[model samples]
Target: MARFLITVVPALGHINPTMPIAEELKRRGHDIAYASGSDMQQYIENQGFRFFTAGFPSFKHYTSYALRKMFEYQGLVSNAFFFKVLIEYNRKLIVDLPPVIQAYKPDVLLVDCITHGGAQLAEVLNLPWATSHPIPGLIPSRDATPFTSWGLPPSQNPAVRACYRIIRLGQGLFYRMFDPAFNSIRASLNLPPLRHCVVTNTLSPYLILIPTCEGFEYARSDWPPQAHLIGPAPWGKVSAQDDECAWIDALPHDRQIIYVTLGTVQVFRSLDFYKTVIAALRDEGYFVVMSIGPVLDKKELEPVPEGFRIEPFVPHAKILPRCAAVIHHGGQGIAQDCIYHGLPSLVVPISQDLYEIATRCVSAGVSLKIPYPRLTPQRLRDALRKVLTDQSIRAATNSLQARFRATNAGATGATLLEQLARTKQPVYRPGSAS
Candidate 1:
């Protein structure tokens, strides 16, 4: 059996999608070892894959502040904090990885596109690596024109091109800063730098996945052959716990339901924003269920007005199917889930690359983006109403949804990885095979 090393960041959004693939690989008789931090150990092991953790600074301390600061500090530091923590806390990670590389001696490596550690490790080991991006931004390609650069729309207007130029400059600065470090890591192991294809989360060619469909995408292009769009990879649904909240049970069935969540990372930080959305949705007399995620105290959010409900977490995969629309933080995971269900979205993007994804969704017409820092009840109401009542949005989303269904991400990804396993040249194990 071919052994494969799959590495990821421990964030649930990245790790969760990786789970099914890991399971599929193990089931195919490949020895799969996952490398990440402690956060996803249980979930990874639960899927029956061997877990290897490269410890990072305890985000346990930040869990309390996590939800509270959902949109705070859009600075470069905040954007790259997880990576900073991964490097600083796990000083030995660079040094410690080689032995595991030697032990497993994987035939190929699969890494989350945004994860620097995994990418560097693959480079060091000289492994043929493929990137599993939760979104479509990892690969820098031009064939996906217009939407190719950071998924932003291409324009001839001086201001827009200027903005794109600035963004590109920033992106270049960020990548160049690490080029030396990554090159050093590769040199240490006498391995060449990594050059691999980006396997995006969506089923679109231009190195971007169009989770929503053709109608939703404003700027379309023919994508690269190396870039595969596998549609939204929705994980299997698990039944909700018997002890669901009373308010959740009491929601009216007459009005179409709208599921609103800031997702786990921003739920606590955006409590006021969530409350405002609840107030607006209730005022509009719509059935609304809000997942506050785990970082907040629902009790403190007490006197939660009538016609609204709150929970620490909800099975979005289960709930999205039942909802008329979804209002979310525009996380790639949530956006994909919304697209998978063909449900329209009002993307309240907070920070970092979220604005880019949200912008793409808005440009595509399947979703509308309301800037997080500027969110208000009226804007929220207007955006939600547009997503819910706009027939064109619904029709376009439905069409995209059909295409998404036809594009079975799980099977497609499995088939590709399996093919890579078979065709890749076997690495010599010296005397070990005897």
Candidate 2:
């Protein structure tokens, strides 16, 4: 059996998707070990994998307002925030992981697409590694717009594609702007200087698995040999605990239901957005269930008006099945869940790839987009009404839902890693021209 080393950040969004694939690998008679933040040790070990952890600072929800604000702003520090964190994270892992690499000697390494620690270790130790890309558009694409495009829509037109390439150049320039900071860390670690931009350098040459379907992403022909699209991680229905379960049973069937979430990260800036949603839909005759996520304080919100509900957190699996529509910060996980359940969405962009997700979902005809800067109570209410009544959007979501459910992401990812382990060669996609 081949031994695999899987690494991830502490965030739930990244870990949740990775767990299914790692579990699948273990079930198929492979050994799985994890390298992640120390905060995640209990959860990772409980899953029965050997874990190596570093003290990754709490970027998800640190108590420091200044630190939280730095991450929330997408202007200068978004990519820098990630690069800086992973630099420190990798510096720690580099010291701790060599002994394990020498004795255990993992045949294949799987890392979160955005993380640099595991990828750096693999390069130093010369292991064949693959990355699980949670957000596919982060990689520059010819057909899809870059997240740095300021809400540009996806298109295949030559002129539009040229615009995409130009924006990609700008993105590369931004990534290069941080070369000094990245190179300093690399020099200390005794790694060679990067030959390309940060995003290009971090990507594995052997395999890069995207946890999304082709139908969901904009059609692109220029993806590299290592890139492949596996469908979203399949999720079983989650049963809520006692009070929440009874409350779900009690939700009224008389009116249309809508699910809302700001996701887990960057929630510190979401109060105004949440307040606007509450004001818009509270008395609108629809039942609105808003999952404020764990980072926000409900005491800070204005008291809930009748017909609206506020939750600390709700599993998307539990609420999407009971709703006619969803309103969310355009995260890939929630967007995939909404599509998998065949529900139209009003995507609200807070920052980063959210705008790209909103744009792609709109391009796919499954969603509508409203940036936080443009969102108003009236606009949100009207958008919700249109999404609920729009036959075209519903049809697209239902059509894509079938495609999303047909493929098993865990199995596809495991097989690709298995192939990489056995051959130590680039695992070109089955039908890829690249």
Candidate 3:
């Protein structure tokens, strides 16, 4: 049996997708251990894997920092603040990981794409490692619009192609601002300076797995040789007692059910958005089950509308199957879950990779995208109406769901990781079958 070491940032979006792969590897008799923040210890242990604190600060610390600094600056300066926090956090991990590696003696390392230190550690240790991107659009491609542009639909028009080139140039200019900080970390570790952009630089030379299918993402012919488009890995906790959520069962079958969430991180910034959504959908005669996230108090959103039920937390795995549609922040975890269950979505992206995911949903014809600046009560209501009534959207969602369901992403990822462990090399090429 091969021994595996998995590393991830403390956020649920990054940690949860890795769970299914870890479970599959364990079921195959491999030993698995995860290094992350102490906050995730219970969740990791519950998944039947050994959990080790990576000796980094909690995610709350960074979130607090962001909250304090976000209003102080805008544009590039604001972006730099977030990146600096991640870099410092990863620095801590780099300092702490060597001891874990020496003790665990893992055969292969599974690194989260966003864990800056894990990629560097893998190189410093010279171990067989693969990067897992829970979200796509991080890896750049020449065949499609720049990932930062939010996955705009591809066009053969020369004007559109030229616009894409200009966008890529702007993206490069923005990324170069961090070269000194990123390279300083590399130089301190006796590593070479990166020749590529930050996102591509984090990729493993051995393999990179994305939990998405081709149908749901833009077609890219320029993906790296190490990249593999594994379908979405099904995950998340399921509520055990149906009786606990029996209110869902009691909701009248007459109206369509809509699951609403802005994801864990963005939900804190979306109180006004939530209020607007509730007001928009209230009179529409639809059932809206909205997860306001744990950080927010339910009392803040008191005087809840007639058709709305608000909770601090609810497992999407249970509620998604019952919903006719989903409204969320375009987080890859819940977005992919909606697609997996054949539920249409209306994505309102706040920031980060969310815009890209939301745009992809639009390109795939399974959802509509509403940028934060353009969000209005009427627009939200209209989007919901379209998502619920559009036969084409329903058909597209079902078609993509069929394709996603046919593939066992968990098994496929496990098998690929096993090959890497046994051979110490990537066995599957980009776009090849597992």
Candidate 4:
């Protein structure tokens, strides 16, 4: 058995997805250790893995519902937030990660796709490594438009492809402005030069395991040979208590239950957004359970609507099985879970690559998309009703769920990583089972 070290982006969304693969490797008699912030130590040790402290500066949480207007233009010319994340993560890891390597001396390094310096650290140390990615479609592609506030689904038509190419030219021009910044960081460690920040900084040349299935993404032939679209690596099941079942059972049988969560990362979602949801679905004869996340107070949104329940947070595994529909912000975890469970959705994207995911889900006919600019009580109400009663959407979701279930992504990805550590070569092969 080989020793493996896991470095993630230090967020719930990124860390949670990698757990399954790490656990699978451990189950096969491999030693596993994770490097991240101090707060995550207990959680990691509880899962039976060694933990290393590699603290990063916490980002100042956004108070506005969307990006500041001045930064909105970056969406047109470049993916500002994504690149900023890559640069920010790299600067920190360059300082904090080296000692961890000295201590662990792992045979293989598995890192989150957006954790920039981990790949560079592997290169500096001359160790085998792979990327455990939670989201796909971030790589700029001619097959699909650039990820922005406005993005297009993938297309084969010449006109659509040409339009996307033109848009990419603008993004490229903006990306070049950061050449000095990226090169300075690379030069400090004697690393190879790179042109694009996202491509060079994050993607591993050896192997990349994207947990979503190929069917969920636009078909692309141009990905690096190491990249594989493995199905989602969700957490193990959460046992439901008798009290939890009883609480769910108490909901009126006459009304269909709806689960609403905007995710935990962005606390900037305004009071207006929740107010709009309550206004639209109030007394609509449906039971709505909404998770407001950790930051907001339920008392702030006083006089909650009838048949509406509010909480700081609730596990998706507990509430999803009982819901007839889901309304989310298009994060990869919830998106995969919705497809896996065959539930229809209404996706309202606020920032980052979420707009791309929401648009792709719309293209697949499994959900309806509403951008922040177009959000309103009437629009949300209408979209929710359509996703709830639309049989075609249900059929489409179920069909895709079957495709997701057909592959064992966790086991498949585990086998590939094992091959990487053992052979120290590219793990993907043409016509090999993924």
Q: Could you tell me the TM-score of candidate 1?
A: 0.78
The 0-to-1 C-alpha lDDT of every candidate, in the order given, reads: 0.62, 0.78, 0.80, 0.77
Candidate 3 deviates by what RMSD?
2.8
Q: What does candidate 2's lDDT look like per residue over 132-182, in tens digits?
A: 888777776655566672557766688887877887777778777767766
- Candidate 3 C-alpha lDDT tens digits along 1-434: 99999988887788878878888999989999999888778767866779888945455545656544542343445556656766777678888888988899999999998788888988888999999988667687776766763446667899989999998788778888877788888898898888543675568888888888898877887777778888888785443433366676677688788899987666446678888887788888888899887567878888988888998666776788789899998888888899999999999887666777888888888998888768999999988889989999999999999999988878888989999998998656845644
Overall local distance difference test of candidate 4: 0.77
**C-alpha RMSD for every candidate:** 6.6, 3.0, 2.8, 3.2
The TM-score obtained by model 4 is 0.90
Better of 1 and 2 by lDDT: 2
Give per-residue CA lDDT, model 4, range 142-255, as digits (tens): 555565446577777888788888877876777776766777888899987788766557788789888887667777767666888878766644433223444665667787
Range of the 10 consecutive residues with the lowest summed lDDT in candidate 2: 234-243
Q: Considering only N, C-alpha and C atoms within 3 Å, which residue pairs clash in candidate 4?
A: 211-231
TM-score winner between candidates 3 and 4:
3
Which regions of candidate 2 are displaced past 4 Å? 38-52, 55-57, 63-105, 142-144, 237-246, 431-434
lDDT of 4 at 126: 86
List TM-score per model, in order. Answer: 0.78, 0.89, 0.92, 0.90
